[model samples]
Target: MHVPDGFINAPVSVAAGAVAAGAVAVSLRGARRELGGTSHAEGGGERTAPLAGLVAAFIFAVQMLNFPVAAGTSGHLLGGALAAILVGPYTGVLCVSVVLLMQGILFADGGLTALGVNITVMGVVTVVVAYGLFRGLVKVLPRKRRSVTVASFAAALISVPAAACVFTAIYAIGGTTDVPVSKVLTAMVGVHVLIGIGEAVITMLTVGAVVAVRPDLVYGARGLTAPLKLRVGGELVDAEPAPVPVAARSPRAVWATGLVTALVLAGFVSFYASASPDGLEKVAADKGIDKNVEEHAAKDSPLADYGVKDISDARISGGLAGVIGVGVMVVAGTGIFWSLRRRGTTDATPTRVPESV
Candidate 1:
């Protein structure tokens, strides 16, 4: 649901911009902890930074592959649920926000002026709702691999409609047109529910796959397995820690694999994505919610609309654009995460212990 320019009045858009800015500020601080703070000897920050970047790139690639939801409506991965499960909530928000930013300025998929709305709805709302519910479910459900996947599915499924409702509420307050709020709400929620199913399945499979290979890398699965307890005297004490697996200590393999997957998805598989309008696009057209929609400022960019400007072949043009997008996203995401991780590491540095007297 990338809100284009003119969908919201200036006042409300500015208000939403403030909210989005605040959310991003908070997420930046929170992401530092998620990236750097870990009890592992291998340094959680070092291992997690690259993975988080890959997650962002993967989300960008996946969003290009829109699956058909209704007769003429399609939906794509929001990435909040997947990112939160893979990384953390704060990082998840940043990931989606980065995607939205790139899409706006480069691809012209989302509007530059509406960046705030898109970030608030697609980035903030989806991550908060998905991660909060995911944590709750993880707490109640059995601590197992399956439980994480199941929780991911549920969280992703709910997050879509939750975002849709939030968008409807925002539009109700400052819609540029005279669309009925009730009708918009009903239609948005109804269609997004189906879209959520697609989100859930994708989340479930992706989380399950990652968990199967490296559960330790998955933030949601981090503490799922409790430490072994040993009875000593009348009390139970934690057993000695197990050695870190050789494979788990390094993220290079996983990073390479993930990057390759993202490249393939965006560079090739996206060509098969449905041509139908997405849920929000369809709703806007049908309900006249886009009556005042303005043209994208970057409409003339070489990569606008996910196609190369002078490339005659649709396949080559789209694929080149997609590849470029993935590359840029990976570099941008990794740089941001690495900076956060460095700051976290500095903050978490220990004071020098006094040498033995």
Candidate 2:
């Protein structure tokens, strides 16, 4: 849900921009520790960079496939928890940032002037809420492979509503039009609650699959203890073996997988996506908050609203956007991750070694 320029008043949008800036600042510092301190340098540098990009592109494509939830309303995966769990929280924020950027600049999905608001609502808030809940649940629940999946589900479910609350609050403050704040809050929270369930299911399945195949790579699942402890002599220890470093995929494999997933989701699957208004649209309409909704600055652009100018076929126009978005995200994410990964490698390398013993 990208908030266009006019929905939120100028004052509120500027305030949101400041908050977003601070959060991004914090995330950059936090990411160094998460990536450098935790992940294996060789593998992380080589693999994580490309993988992060793929994750962003993946989130973008998946978001296009909005599902029908209720009459006049639809829900799409916001993908904060999904990205955070797969990669890391800092990187997840960046992933969502990249998606918003592409949407605002190229596809006119969101407003350029309101890009900060969209990133703050969809990226920063979602990751913070999702990661916080996931960590808390993991601590209390029995640690198992399913625990990660379960935690992911719970986190994603909660995160969507949390984002809705945030948006509602923002509207309460800087809403350009007069509307009842209580009604907006109630509607925003209510519809988002249903959307949360769908988010949870998708997150659970995705996390479960990754944990099954490459548990070690899951940033959230790191250091997870097995549910059952084994008795060894007198004391007990985790039944699971220590995770080994998984090898990076061949370059061809990474390239092929990311591209293919982006293509399928954007091109074909998008056709089946629900036509109903998304969470933001529904809330805006019902709450009368969209009375001042401004047309996007890039409204006249060729790629406006994820369509090409000359393309008569809706499928083809959207398909091209999906592809281009994927390409852009992959390149951008790869660049950022690659730099972080390289820094990690540089830090890990020994400056000097003994020549003789």
**lDDT agreement with native, every candidate:** 0.91, 0.80
TM-scores for candidates 1 onward, in order = 0.95, 0.88
Model 1, residue 297: C-alpha shift (Å): 0.6
Q: Name the best candidate (by lDDT).
A: 1
Residues 27-67 of candidate 1 have per-residue lDDT tens digits of: 99999999986566333667788888899899999999999
**lDDT against true structure, model 1:** 0.91
Candidate 1 versus the native: TM-score?
0.95
Q: Please list the residue runs of candidate 2 whose C-alpha ends up more than 4 Å from where it truly belongs after superposition.
A: 37-45, 226-259, 347-357
Q: Candidate 1: which pairs clash?
A: none
The C-alpha RMSD of each candidate to the native structure, in angstroms, is: 2.3, 4.0
Most accurate candidate by TM-score: 1
Report how far off residue 182 is in candidate 1 (Å).
0.5
Residue 42 in model 1: lDDT:
35
